[model samples]
Target: MLNAVIIGCGGRGQIFAEYAKQYPNEMRVFAIAEKRDYLREKMKKEYDIDDKYIFSDYHDLFEKGKIGDVIFIATQDNQHIEPALMALSAGYKNLMVEKPIDRDLKKCILLSKKAKEYGAKLQICHSLRFAPFYRKMKELIDTGVIGEVKHINQTEGVGYFHQAHSYVRGDWANEDKSSPMILAKCCHDMDLLVYLTGSHTARVSSYGLGGFFSEKNAPEGSSARCIDCKISDKCPYNAVRIYEERPNTTGRGAVEKEGFSNLEDAMRKGRYGRCVFRCDNDVVDHQVSNIMFENGATANLTMTAFTKDCNRVTRVMGTYGEIVGSFNDFEIYVKPFLGNDKKYEVEKIESGHGGADTVVVADFLASARGEKEMCTPIDISIESHAMCEAAEISRRTGKSIEIADIMSDKEGALL
Candidate 1:
């Protein structure tokens, strides 16, 4: 069985390690590094790892030298690089770091180049690329049923409550602390768009309303916290309803290490308990990015947090026909200019993120074992990351940003 050392045993790390439980014969968790004492202890007990293999600081874990077949770096957006550099330096040759690799443009490219220099296999965790829903989409597009991919129009419906939970009051609320909404939330889509077109982004022009979720938009009766708000009963984003009454904890600090320290007292005093509109959030509530690919294809991506359900709706237009689908329905429709329309439906999955999370771990394990080629390698990951960084710059400056200016390396279509 392949072995893994989980860095940052938070939500993502825990989810990746879960694959070991599902298929113990294929892989197992050998060690864990986490800042939270509780999380480290939790992983040690669950994985049956010895005390020597658990660390409150990742430095200690890396200082121990390579301990497993691969390392899973699932730290925060800005925290991925240091641990990754440490891992590569420690002689660990295979790694799976979660998406939005880093907010810094140069650092993203640097990490990939460093991995190449070290002859290491690095994969970014853009899990949706492994989702069956998108996989079938790729399969159909690759078959040329839709002809040359020319234009893609996609929308990420960041549902109201979900947006309120994740972007307004959770760990990703601030750009300084985390990442821009585009990179942190929609980098998955950006990467998939690049994958779909089989080309890298050449340029991007983006616009967004960054102040929509601020105190200026708070309702009349909205107080600082849901527990104290007079309109908590009528407010849709009531933290109490989300974290307690209904118990649907998507981002209301389900991971204690993510900052909602105590569930019982959090409703009155914690970050998750704050009113969504009044929180110190700076990410956009609505964003639109117009993109130009190196191969003459174009795409538009829209992300908004006002939809009823959190899902994605995409339409890919080609030379011969067009394809459209909704992730909420877990299906796609292929309509050709002359052929009969076809509908493909994906059955509901038991694993999280529609089973993409577990599938990525499985794929990573096989790639680490040299049984299969890595799907989302470092260069491709950098390409997607550069796209988002350029979009963010455009969103801020009102000028179209060129990926070439952002990436010094002309790898892929960047040339």
Candidate 2:
């Protein structure tokens, strides 16, 4: 059996631990490292991990604990770099790190080089790449059912209320803490597009802003708390009301940390935990990107935080046919238009993205054991990461950015 360790006992860390437990016969969670005292204690009790195996700092886990065969890094967006490097340098042979690698392109490049030089196997957590629905779509496309793809469209409906709670007024509201919305949230989408199209995005154009999630846009005299706000009944972005009606729903807060000392304090302050419109949420709530594939095809992407519902919609168009689908529990639909008539195929999955998390972890484990190839490699992730950064630049500068111009070398491309 391979010994394993998980850093960060927050939500993502917990999920990784659960997966590790599922494969107890193959791997075991031998240690845990977390910064928050409550979370550390919670992990101990929740996972039954011994106190001796817990450390306040992740580096301390690597320094003092027995070296695990593989390390799982699921920390916050801006906090993955040091622990990853430390683990590799400490002689861990395998690593499965969460997506985007790092916010800083230069640092990611340097770490990639170090991993290659040190002979430490690396697997990035682009979970959607392993989603069964997407995998089937890739297979169909490869078999020419989608033909030579000519155009693609991807839409991510980041509900307005959830964006306010988790992004605008929450932990990742600030770019300094997480990253631009493109990098932090939409890297998965960009990477998915690149992976399916099998082409590098030659160029991109973007436009977005902090339109609706700001104090100036809020109704006058409205309290920040949706439960207390006078407009709670009519306002579209009411959280308390929404959650009360849909208890089992997953919000962005579910995926991210809120960073507020208390929910009541946020409501009173009206910035971090308060009313959606009244908070100091400056992150972009809506954005669009147009990408030109190397094969001269184009893909359009839309991200919005002001939707009545939440989900992702995708369509791939080719010379002979087209494949269209949705990821948010909607039925997957494929239409093949071959001049005679249109044929439709619909498949319903058991989980969101059709068990993406399972596939991602299983594939990584197989790759670590040298039993299979990576569905998403460092080089592919680098392309998606750069695309996200460049799209942000385009949105800020109001200009088109060329991928070739930004990354002219293989080293740069891997970043």
Candidate 3:
């Protein structure tokens, strides 16, 4: 069996570890490095990991020498690069890191260079690439059902509650702390567009603003915390109702770390209890980007926090046909210029991220075993990140920015 080491025991890291429980013969967690005592102990008990192999710091784990064949880094947005570079230098041969590789372009480039220097096999968890709905879309596009692609439109409806939880009040609420909404949340969509079109983004122009979820929009007479607010009962984003009443269902990390019984205690004392409108969040609630690809294809992307929580929706137009679909229904329709339209429905699977979480883990394990190639390599993933960086730049500068401009060094020299 292939042994694996996990760097974070949060939701995403735990999701990867679950694959070991489902397929014990294929892979298993051999070591873990998590700072949270509860999360570390929880993973140890769940995976039957040895005490000697558990570490409070990733550096400590690395100092213990190579403990497994693969290192899975699922830390927060800004926490990905250092651990990745350390792991590669420590002789780990396989790695599965979460997306946006790094919020900084130069650091991302450095990590990629180090991985190549060490001949390490790396896969960024662009899980959507492994999802059946997207895979089917790719297959259809490859078969020329859509002919030569000319334009595409994609939308990510970051459900109202989800946006509040993740981008408004949760860890990624601030651009300075995490990343721009485009990089932190919509990098997957950007990557999806590139993967589907099979072309690099040439230039990007974007527009976005944080119109809602500001101190100016807070409800009148609202208190800082939901528990103390008089309007908590009626407020849609009441922290008490979201965390205490429906902790098991609504709370993401809290569900795993705090549990349903202690949710009230956690929310009352944590950042999760802050009023969405009054919080220090600066990330945009809505944004749109227009992109031109190297192959002359064009695409538009919209990300908004005002819609109902649902799967992504996409429409692709080509010379011979057009395709439209949503992740919510796991279905797609293709209409040719001449004949009858065709519809395809994906078989449902009970897994996170539209059944992508499990499939990506399986692929990572297979790739680690040297039986298959990584579907989302670091080189390809960086292109999507570059597009996001350009979009953010464009959004701030009020001018279209070329993808090459963002990828270039400070001297304006292309790397």
| Candidate 2 segments exceeding 4 Å error | 245-272, 339-353, 409-415
Candidate 3 lDDT over residue span 202-306, tens digit each:
999999998699888888989888878998888888877766645545575644544433666657777777888878888999999999999999999999998
Any residue pairs clashing in model 3, and if so which? none
* Tens-digit per-residue lDDT, 232-284, candidate 2: 77776676654444433333233224443444443444343367766555678
Clash list (residue pairs), candidate 2: 224-275
TM-score of each: 0.94, 0.90, 0.95
Tell me how far the alpha carbon of residue 262 in candidate 1 is from the true structure, in angstroms, after superposition. 5.7
Sorted on lDDT, best first, the list reads 3, 1, 2
Clash count for candidate 3 is 0
The runs of at least 3 residues in candidate 3 whose Cα sits more than 4 Å from the true structure, single-residue gaps closed, are 244-252, 255-261, 410-415
Candidate 3: residue 338 lDDT (0-100) = 89
Report the lDDT tens digits of candidate 1 across residue range 310-360.
888989999999889887688889999997999998866667666688889
Reference-based lDDT, residue 155, model 2 = 91
Clashes of each: 0, 1, 0
lDDT-superior candidate, 1 or 3: 3
What is the full ranking by TM-score, best candidate first?
A: 3, 1, 2
